[model samples]
Target chain A: MAFGKDHELHQRRFGRNLWVGACLLGFVAIVFGLTVVKVTRDGPIEGFDHTVRPQMTEGAK
Target chain B: MTDTSILPPQSGEAGFGDYFALLKPRVMSLVVFTALVGLLVAPVPVHPMVAFASVLFIAIGAGASGALNMWWDADIDQIMKRTKGRPVPSGRVTPGEALQIGMWLSCFAVVMLLLSANPVAAGLLAFTIFFYAVVYTMWLKRWTPQNIVIGGAAGAFPPMIGWAVATGGVSVESVLMFALIFMWTPPHFWALALFMKSDYADAGVPMLTVTHGRRETRRQILIYTLILVPVALGTGLTSIGGPLYMAVALVLNLAFLKGAVDIWRRKEEEAEADGYAVEKKVFRLSLYYLFLHFGALLAQAVLRVYGIGGW
Candidate 1:
């Protein structure tokens, strides 16, 4: 909506828009990169254990 | 900055920081903190990366809602001194730009959240964005005196969203977290309404203080705060609760009740004479009240990590 306008606020917002978009994409990249690296057979990087089997309740079959 | 009172932003006036102002960073910070607490306190532990991603996207979703709120409320904002300096109202950013930012960010946050977390969590996040932007901002806000009461749901949904991100479904724990914010919202906002009387009146928003008299509003504040006490303390009885949380909740609720009582007993003339100092104090306490409650919840989670706290 503000593409054609050439005011200082508009220009400033446009510049910020680029930086914010870039930063968001960068964050996504970092997250996905970490996800892929952490999804290995060995398990996640921070030692988040997803390997525990659920213990059955008492009197189970 | 040159006055763009009748026109668009003046040339060479606003900076990049002005665009960030539209995000309502203060509100987003609260959402991030509470959502983090929710995720931390969940029964199911999540991957650290996933937890980070979920909180980040939820914060983005909050910012998106803020942008849209600024867009929709620009008119009322321009009328009220409290909001006159907002990006849209101040001519630092146009309404169209605000809408564009809001829509794009909302979609990005929801989609990224889906990628980072499960569908249930992402869906709730999407619904939260929609509720805050479309449901509350566009529909309910201008239409009813009960707006804050109902619209508070938009703010209340974060902890639920966080819990969903962790567990991939709703549960009583999550509902209680939602209830904590939902019930507290009325009194929290009504306190502000009591102090900032002219802002809503000038903006034509049907705040409790505007529709009902301040006496009734103060009475309602006491009533809601009375009700809010149990909900705050109720968390202590849940699995998330512990001795520390119970202790904190007990003292906070008593002090909060006293604050409400103090406000309830005051006459308008006395309030005006004191420059609404008591009202302002209560408003500040409300901020700390929520913050401390959530902080206690987070503390319980930390203790649980050491295998100590939580029943």
Candidate 2:
């Protein structure tokens, strides 16, 4: 199929193998990059501190 | 002349992909990425699901603007080689139908954003649609050589909208993001105009290259690029970026500035001697230049999660 052919043809040709490979590579890169930082770092990153407990109290002032 | 035997009429069938092409998926992807960066970098936290929905609606709104742009610019697009094969110009979609789709999607995306986010984000989304479809496409594009320079603001709004969605208001951070893209637009687009001067000339569009001259366009490209480098790096000095992002910005801006200088120093005759290949390379690099800058922002956001000082 040509580059700008219909969606189905695009899916059949580039979608299955090439698209999946590209996406998988992106995912792996992100995960690997994060893991590298996690291993070398001393503590949780500032912006991504998901472990910080949220205050449950309502505004009492 | 005698009447012939009855024959079957041809079907005017259009598919979903054709409709999708009208949305300008490449542009939408940039909108989505930049908007997501805005959301991620905001001081206030939003639920993950809500953030996802907000970005989705923003992407849809960008698509709506693209569709409307195609509908309005179909005449010029049909003549310009760069845009001649767009869905509307190629007869895959009718202008009326494209207009309907664009307007309907514009409303749908705005309402969805309003429901999921706040009114400020919704208002910005609406203004962006109106700016692109009416102000830029309808008024400025045909009138002036500086159309893309001023009109590029419409494309620069998504990150601000995303920041508004996360924080419920505007901030300097969002404005910096807006300014980065807004300043980058002229040099990035003018580089292409330098090489494709003939295309604009053929289509009778008054691009800077066609109206002023290639030398003037090259000078403008260098000036804007010089301005853009500082703005791009300034975003790194803000709360949304950190050391890593700053390093990337410095390197990228230096390279971009070098490219602009090379372009400025060359004459059109010198460039054209090699088929204007240098200008074309700069144009192609400009595309990646934006993507890499934004991609660095996304990387900074992820790094902030692991304590790399993004925030």
Candidate 3:
């Protein structure tokens, strides 16, 4: 039961897990950044939030 | 983290890099670069964040299709020298996992693209994935000698999709870019087939070389290169083109045509003696031929901002 060195398989698996975690974090950051830019842009805010927006409604213009 | 000594480690168990290898990163780099150029060269200016996200999604879609290809082509890949070491054929990644990853990423990329860009771009990206994965990899690859000719349309779509991301529709410029790639694909691939020897034949792939004789493949390469000259030069005459693009296209096309001619002229005896050196050189130049043309376009776009580009 004495632990000397980690097995090679475990190290590879660990590295894989770390990279997957990093990818997930990066994806989250991109989504967050996109949300900020999209909401703050010059035009009216349009999202799929279920409720109808006035600008999107027919005959509003 | 598990018990250290009991279970023997499984050989060929996949690592993260193996999964990434399933995506064919080299091909993805070409997709990213061409798509970026397509987006940047458009007349409409895109928001940096939106542009970045769109390109990323496009790349993901491309990677997904590549995974699908690796999954489906595993059998033939195991027979081909260059592809036998790929993730699926090498047994580092399972075919089932590759298919699952491909499908999931394809959906994710298309949905994210629709949200990030426009429906048109998303639709094109979806079609591209389908074309590459289902049409090219599944059907045409095994069934026809002209597989690469038609399958090339799958690769040629990215620039058009990139243009659609900015313009929300098609245009002559985008069509021209697509044509440039479509025409270039045959000659480029034929040159590789010439040098690759019998990989396609051994794999039962009906490449032009395997179906038609090598002389016919050589002749076809020259014909396609001849046709490609007009399309490549014609792009230089469009709005995306300028003096710089014309200059670069002229020089590059001449060199490419010369290489094609050299390939066509060399006899089989001399080629075998020299180890297809002329074909190899032509193949190398073809790589630079496409890149420099795209680079010149980007350069022209940049120069236009400085009042020195565009006629």
Error in Å for residue B40 of model 1: 0.5
Error of 2 at B108 (Å): 0.5
User: Candidate 2: global Cα-lDDT?
Assistant: 0.82
What is the lDDT of every predicted structure here? 0.85, 0.82, 0.90
Q: What's each prediction's TM-score?
A: 0.85, 0.79, 0.90
Q: Pick the candidate with the highest lDDT.
A: 3
Candidate 1 Cα misplacement greater than 4 A, ranges: A1-25, A41-61, B1-15
Ordered list by TM-score, greatest first: 3, 1, 2
Task: DockQ each candidate and list the results.
Answer: 0.22, 0.04, 0.58
lDDT of 3 by residue, B124-147 (tens): 999999999999998888899999
Candidate that scores best on TM-score: 3
Clashing pairs in 3: none
Give lDDT: candidate 3, residue B266.
82
Question: What lDDT tens digits, residue by residue, belong to model 2 across residues B1-311?
Answer: 00111211212545566777899999998899889988887878776667877898899899999999888777778777778787777776777778998999999889978977889999999999999988998888878999988888998999999999989999888999999989989998888877664576665567898788889999999999988988888888888878878888888888889889999999878998998777888888788878787778878878777887664
